[model samples]
Target: MSGSILNLFSLQGKTAIITGGTGGIGLAITTALAEAGANIISIEVPHDPASPLLRQAIEATGRKITVYDCNLKDHESIRATFHAIWASGSVPDILVNCAGITRHMKVEDTPVQDLDDVMAINFRGTYLCIQEFGRELLRLQRPGKIINFASIAAFLAQTNISAYCSSKAAVQNLTRAVSNEWAGKGITCNAICPGFIHTKMCEDLYTDKEFSARVVARTSMGRWGEPEDIRGLAVFLASAASDFITGESVFVDGGIMGR
Candidate 1:
C-alpha cells in the first residue's frame, strides 16, 4: 500500500488526551496511541499516584507523554487543567474519556450518594472534558476524534451495578448526541463497550475461581479480555481510519454480546 493509504492509521504529529490513563485498560490504550506516533497527555486526579509502568511503556515507543493530575469531578479543576494544557502549546487532536468509577450495589441497597458519585465522574466528567476540549478544536477549525468509554453492561442488564449500568448507558447516548451536534464541525464521537476485561478493577472476580470460570464460559473466546485487547480499537477510533465512522458504539467484547 502507498504511504498515503497507510497514513490513515498513522497518528504522526497528533496529540491525544486520555482521562484515567494511569493504569489498566486506559494505560494500554495510551501506549498504543503513543506507538502510533501521537503525543499522549494522561489526566487523572491529584491523589492518584502516577504509574511508572505506563510512563516506561509510552517512553519505550519513543513518543512524548505528559501526566496531569486534575480532579474531573470538579469543574474548576478541569478548567484549570485545560488552561495548563493550552499553555503547554499542545492542543489535543483526540480525547478519550476513560476516567470512571463503579460501585457494586444492588438497586435497592445503592446509596443516593453512591449514585451521584458514579454519575459525577463517569457521565459528568466525560461531558465536561468533551465540552472544553471540543470547543478548542472547533475554534481552531480542526477535525478531532473523541472516544468515550462505555460498558457491555450498558447493553445488558447486570446485577448489583444499577448505577454503573445506567451511567455507561448514558455515556453511549451522550456519544451519539455529541456526534450529531459536532459531525458537521469535523468531529467524530464514538463509544467503546468492553466486556469483562481482566484489569485491577476486576481482580476480585478473577481471584474467585468459580466466578472466573463462569465469566470465561460466558465469553465465546473462552477467556477474559486483557487490557491490550482494547488497544487496537482505541487506536482505530482515534485515527483517520475511522473518520467516516461516527455516533457508533464499537464493542470490544470477546463475542460475549453475540452469545
Candidate 2:
C-alpha cells in the first residue's frame, strides 16, 4: 500500500473504548486497534481474570490500555463508566460495542428471563453505550466512529437461538438508525456481522464433530474463522479509511454468507 493509503488507516493519538475487550473476539479487536496505534480503554466485567492478560497483550504492542469494570446490562452502569473514563482524561475517538450474550434454547422452551437477559446485553447495552459515547462526541464536536457487533444470526434464523437472533437483528437496525442520525455530525456508525468464528461463545457447538463438519462444509473457505480473522475489518472500520462508510453491516464470514 502507498503511504497515503497506510496513513488513512493510522489511529495515532486516537483512543478507543471497547466493551468486552478482555477475551475472545473482543481481545482480537483490542489488539487490532492498539496495533494500529490507538490507545485502548477496555470495559470488562468486574474482576474478570482476563483483564490483566489483556493489559499485558496491549502493552506488548507499545500502546496504552486501561481496563474499567462495568456491567453492560445496566444503563446506569454504562453511563457511570463513561463518566469515569472521561474523568481519567481518555476521551475516546471510537466506541466498539462488542459485548453480548446468547441462549441456546428453542423459543417455546426459553424462559422470559432468558430472553430478557439476551436482549438486555446484546441490544440494550449496545444502545446505552452508544448513547453515552455519542453524547460526549457531540458535546466536544469531534469526529468519531462506532462499531457494533451484530452477527450472521441477524440475517438468518438459526434453530435454538431465537433470542440471540432477535437481539442481533435489533442491533443491525440500531446501527443504521445511529448512523442516520450521527453521520452528518462527523460520527459514523456501522455493524460487523460475523459468521461461525471459533470463539469461546460457540465452543461447544464447534467442538461437536458433526456440527463442526457442517460449519466447515458450509463456509466456502472450508474452515472456522479465528479471532485474528476479525482484525483487518475491525481496524478499517475504526480508522479514517472507512470515514465514507456508515450504516452498513460488513460481514467477515469467510464466504458463509455467500453460500
Best by lDDT: 2
Each candidate's lDDT (Cα)?
0.91, 0.93
lDDT of 1 by residue, 82-186 (tens): 889988898769999998889997798999999999999999999999999998998889999999999999999899999999999999999999999999998
The predictions' CA RMSDs to the true structure, in order, are 1.2, 1.0
Q: Which stretches of candidate 1 lie over 4 Å from their true place?
A: none
Assess the local accuracy of residue 148 in candidate 2 as a C-alpha lDDT between 0 and 100: 97
Angstrom error at residue 226, model 1: 0.4
lDDT of 2 by residue, 126-194 (tens): 999999999999999999999999999999889999999999999999999999999999999999999
Candidate 2: Cα lDDT at 135: 94
lDDT of 2 at 85: 92
lDDT of 1 at 25: 90
